[model samples]
Target chain A: MQTEQITETQKENKKQSTWRTAVSALLIFIAVPATIYLGWKFADRQHYIVSLLIILYSMVPFFLMYEKRKPQARELVVIAVMCAIAVVSRAAFIWAPHFKPMTAIVMITGIAFGATAGFLTGAVSGFVSNFIFGQGVWTPWQMFAAGIAGFLAGILMHKGILKKKRLHLCIFGGLTVMLIVGPLLDTSALFTMASGISWESARLIYLSGLPVNAIHATATVLTLFFFSKPMLEKLDRIKLKYGMMGD
Target chain B: MDDAFSGYHPAVNFIFFIGAIVFGMFFTHSAFLCASVFTSMLYYLLLMGRKGIKLLCTMLMLFFALSFINPLLNTQGDTVLFTYIGERPFTLEALMYGFVTGGMFVSVLLWFACYNCIMTSDKFIYLFGWCIPTISLLLSMVLRMVPNFKVKIMTIAGARKCVGKAPVNGDKKEKLQNSMDMLSVLTSWALEGAVVTADSMRSRGYGSGKQSNFSIYRPSVRDMAAGIIMLFCIVLTIICAALGGMEVAYFPVFILPEANIITILGVIGYTAFLLLPSIIHIWEEATWNILRSRI
Candidate 1:
């Protein structure tokens, strides 16, 4: 009878997990594209609104998945701690514009905890830091860029393509910031501040962002080179001591 | 000084800002842009006082820079003001478009500055907590942790200083290394403390059932009145915009909308909405002065 009950509970858990998987897939594959299509169709000229909606929609699946998991308090605390570190580090380095260890710390969180935790750390850091730096139209874009960086870091680490070594992590961090986060933010500048969406204006925006992106990328690479090992070890120690955030 | 507008319900504050920012972003008509930039500057000044002047000057610089750059990049207009290198003709239409765009961007920035002052974090959490409990809880936790970590880091640095190991003075690379060491130490301390915090939270039955949120905000009759007025203005302006009353064209030629009744009403609505907070503050100041004099 005990064995039967255990199997029954397992079956129920399996069903719930499958349902969640389906819902997340639907949100990502169907809802996101539908939103982009409709937003483009109706709000052709309103680039800011359209892009903002697309970002908000794309983020829904991650939040939904996280909420559905019913994460433990320890898990939440770990994510919060990562976010706080990112924000604090950004604040600590305020004198050096574009040279923030925030992205590097966020990537470490991803490499240590997992993708979801990493994303949350990045997004929350982007948001809370804006409280100090002053929120603007760039807030959402910054959040999205950082979150994606964390997400990619988590995925690559999980796939073994991104090793924990200093050289590997530094290269990954530099490339991610320059290729992904930088362009995403520059795109926001184009959509929000630029008058028109011509190729010329877009090129100008991207070119203007290059110097800032280079500085940011250098910061990330330096941070990862010096800090990733000890930070990862510390995170591993916490997980081992508390036996939490293993998943 | 306390802002009278901020005393309203959080929803009212959020609605007003959303309206102001959205309209400011979407509208490109020169009249509407002028109203937006002017009112946003006024409200920002009211919110920030003299400290805002420096930022306003920076914003003006940004506005001029953006306005100047736009004509150089976009050479699509008919009226050529001048030709630069590579036969790139700078057009008057592009310059005007640039000015309108720059005005919109600056106004949005100013409105956001005012919003940062008015809508504090607790209010933001209160407004969204019920609908998104998990995210809101996470947001609050992160916000709580940021300051906590800052204090902890300072303490750690102080402790390090007592040991003569603080990163106070060094060459650039050495300073970077010292800071990184400090960060690593802080991370370990923070992570260890976090486990205790999580355990304490768990002991308090945090995830046992649906969590309850507490807030001090309660909408009153005055808030209701403010909400109604804001909604009426927003709806009127949106309707006017939908009816093509706020239409503007910039490419190839510049065309401003005719001064029709609907367009005028839309502009008035837009201006009134943007000016609401400043008006409330000014009125409150006057009333306070009168009451003080009587007293």
Candidate 2:
């Protein structure tokens, strides 16, 4: 009789789960059409809003999972701030033309903090800084490209490529990223902005990006190799002082 | 970042999901100019209400600085600002165009920031997962992969340091060697992890002939009603856009025949309609909580 009761409970749970799945399916069906329709409507208006919406939308699934995987507020704030700083610093190089230095800072941030932080920093910086010059559909890709640079660096650190003293290797990797991934990102942006097939335009954009990319990589390598461990240690001390880092 | 992935209002997520697609379709045209200006101001107001407006201000300042400086450096415009040492052109037109473009760019970014602040990532998955399980799963895996990859990097770096060859600040050759080593380790681990995941998923019949099922949070009747209204708004907006009722152009002189009085009203009406779901849901929840408190 007890075994039968347990089986009955199981059946009830299955029924409930099935109901949940059906509702979820219906919501998805509604969402896709709405997205496409909205896209068609907003097309040729404020391109930035679209980008803003996507970045914001990307946050939704994570938010839904928050209760099961709670994130610390302090961590989010730090990541946001770090990203803001990284992007702004890169923008500053537009005047001074320093590529290596900025990249190093980005790399260090990623290596020490982790990929999400790197992504946040890269994305936030790109988006925020771009707003000053002009905004369009290209912003997300710019954010993705720059942020991914830091993200990849962080991943390398995870795999043991970046270390406390491996300055040269980190620098080499940073340069390789510029030559390879950097141009491709710029190309994609140009392609999206207009169907301009001009090699000249592509070359111009790529050339313009070179200095900034170099600065970013060089700065990232230097900071990652030298200051990261110490700075991270200092951050830990600050956390301890403020009672921010949770056990 | 405890809240890095939490507290997304469903209403906000829905707004953004539709909003992004709109941006994707219309970014190249001149109407984007007007939309950029209008939305920038709206975004500023939205941020101000949230008491998080300083971020927008900071970003705007940067935009101004970049627009002005970019022209000076590039020296490629027609209406020259001043002759430099090489007689390089710095057109007033380019600077002005850049400024408008820059403003548009920043406004969009601020919009995204606002979105990020309000909407968490999980809602994105829940909204998309039911219809597109394969893509949703891939996204989920990517998110999880980030932290996992970080852990592995730290572990390997520590292990290498112990074995001595800790070339953090080495010559170019040493740096090259270390990078390659790191890549090799990362690639192997990633491949292994992918294989394991595939095997595990197959065991559970993830991609078998049988249709898969997912358990998710249930939407109330109110949620369904809200969803319907949003869909209606989306359709209306598309019609408005397609009919050219929303188009705006500038630089042959900024004009928007699409922004006729009737079309403007329609746009406003549809937007309100889209927002009805959120307003209703919030009101219902408040009433329920209040009654529960009284009891």
Clashes by residue pair, model 1: none
DockQ score for candidate 2: 0.06
Superposition-based RMSD of candidate 2 using all C-alpha atoms, in angstroms: 13.4
lDDT of 1: 0.85
Docking quality of model 1: it rates as: medium
Query: Which TM-score values does chain B get in all models?
Result: 0.96, 0.63
* Per-model TM-score versus the true fold: 0.92, 0.50
Q: For every model in order, what is the number of clashing pairs?
A: 0, 72
Model 2, runs deviating above 4 Å: A1-183, A188-204, A212-247, B1-15, B20-54, B65-100, B115-121, B130-132, B167-172, B186-198, B209-214, B247-249, B255-259, B270-295
Q: What is the TM-score of chain B in candidate 2?
A: 0.63
Docking class of 2: incorrect
User: All candidates' lDDT scores?
Assistant: 0.85, 0.51
Error of 2 at B167 (Å): 5.7
**What ranges in model 1 sit over 4 Å off?**
A1-45, A91-98
The best candidate in terms of lDDT: 1
